[model samples]
Target: MKIPTAAGFVTLMLFCLVHAEICPLSCICKPLGEMKGWLVDCSSKGLKEVPALSVSTRKLYLQNNSMTTVRAGAFDNLRNLEEVNVSDNPWNCDCDILYLKLWLEDFSESSIANVICATPASNERKPLSQLSGNELDSCRKSLPIKCLDFFWRDLALITFAVLVLILTLCALRKHLRKIVLCV
Candidate 1:
């Protein structure tokens, strides 16, 4: 076999460096034409926030990290994001986190169900789906009046049915008494 030429080796090294720069942090960024997903695995990296990713990234994994605070616009550029896992991170529960929590809740394909808070707060380790919007706003600590409205609607329906049944029973009793008296 012939030895590789000096010029060929230098060109190969330059190509490698250029390709490495485009790779995402802790991820294998593969460009599949103009429309395809980039895979990211950022677990256990002690990342405080998500790193810059290509617009092609659809699935992201930031689990088991030291991330304490995620800024509002951290994921704004990733419009194609379909799945994300930020589980096992030490999430700081505050009003600032409200936007991300609410956005995750509303995202059609995102699954933050396992993402939990690690803190001195009451909702620690709680699944996000199990918590109501008011409970999620526990930092605010005031329940929304919508809960009361739901309660009243159910109560009113039951009360109306009971009154209708009572009136029907009274009419039946009166009619039975008249028949007995006639007999």
Candidate 2:
């Protein structure tokens, strides 16, 4: 009976060790009971960037870090995420931050309420949830320079087409009048 108990303990220990190894190096991960998911805690790590998270993360804590922005699709793999805290960080609310804001809005609206801007002076301390697309620094420049080039090229083609149509009408006016007189 003792030998069987010891073997069970060893098996459990090995399982736990392997499970813990799935967590990111910069964060702490704990199972959320019965294989539901993990509770990943990366708060107050002074992290400049979001650490890679386990796919099974359900509750993520990233508050009080130095992170300025979360890359686009950073949390896409966490299909089981139920809650996330990204407050108290120096989030630079620029065009790059749009992804985080939009993601939070779709994932959990309440989470974005506490996310505040920490850069670009005008947006400092402003709630990320309150920011409009126009408020972001480079968002207003959404139309690229290449788009302008296309606009100019299209305008020139339209103008040339109109000029050719006018010339054709002028050249045919004498024939039109002759036809009218004969009729």
Candidate 3:
């Protein structure tokens, strides 16, 4: 096969460059493979928010940032994302971050370990991947007051039923006494 001429090679390179996805200005991007897409690195950038990523981003690195919360569906656009690193970030593991916790559980061990929770003392230092979806759901649902209300409602109903039963028994007893006296 004949080697490509300089002009032909330059044209090919230009074509590839034009078709390649551009990484966010705040992060560095490395092309992984034809099907894998770009690996975006936003580590140590002091980012309080996640940068807009290209749909072609396959892997993302956001370690050691100051992100307190990541909104739901933040990664919905990056459907091909395979790996992510946010281990050193001081994550506030509150209701707002519950989605991230649930999302982490869908990955493998290596990917899961890359994210560690920093806040909500109960979950501190825990791998985000290990957090169960149900647990996160519980965190998202502020059900304590509702549960207490149900408890009180049931208690009142039971107390009312018990009082009615006691009153019925007393009335029946008085009726039986009157019948025995008449007999």
Candidate 4:
């Protein structure tokens, strides 16, 4: 019985060793009870960027990091994510962070209430979850007017109307000249 217990302990140690490689070098990851994934704790690490997380990550703690921006679709592959803590980071509330803001909106309000904007004085300390769609729209870069916005058919119709008006005005002027000549 003692031998079997020792073997079980060795096996558990080996499992933890193998799993250690799955976590980021800068972060500590531990499994939750009976859960299928890890809880990544990367808070207060002064990390400049988000650590590479596995598909098995359930919760991410990144508070008090130096990350000012998060790349778009950064968490797209993490399907099991239940909570993300990104508070106390110097968040730049700009177009770069628009994706994160939109993604936070998908989670429960309580889960996202902790995410606050740290920059753009107008939005400083505001909860990301509470921002309205129109308010969030401020983070998106405005689309420039492109030729595609106007249909060719509409332009053609306007051109045709202008040509007809010019022709009618010219004919009327000619008729008026004739009438003046007759007088």
What lDDT would each prediction earn against the true structure? 0.73, 0.89, 0.78, 0.80
- The best-first sequence of candidates by lDDT reads 2, 4, 3, 1
* Global CA lDDT computed for model 3: 0.78
Compared with the true structure, model 1 gives a TM-score of 0.58
Q: Give a tens-digit lDDT track for model 1, residues 5-111.
A: 99999999997785565455565555545567666777788788878776767778788888866787778778887778887888765555676677777774246
- Clashes per model (N, Cα, C within 3 A): 0, 0, 0, 0
Best by lDDT: 2
Residues 10-83 of candidate 2 have per-residue lDDT tens digits of 99999877766657677888888988989989899899888877788999999999999989889888888999
For candidate 1, the per-residue lDDT at 30 reads 53
Candidate 1 residue pairs in backbone clash: none
RMSD of 3: 10.3
- Using TM-score, rank the candidates from best to worst: 2, 4, 3, 1
Per-candidate TM equals: 0.58, 0.71, 0.60, 0.65
Query: Which parts of model 2 have CA positions greater than 4 angstroms off?
Result: 1-17, 144-183
Which prediction has more favorable TM-score, 3 or 4? 4
- Summing lDDT over every window of 10 consecutive residues in candidate 4, give the lowest-scoring window: 132-141
Error of 3 at 12 (Å): 14
Please give the distance, in angstroms, between residue 179's alpha carbon in candidate 4 and its true position after superposition: 49
What TM-score does prediction 4 earn? 0.65
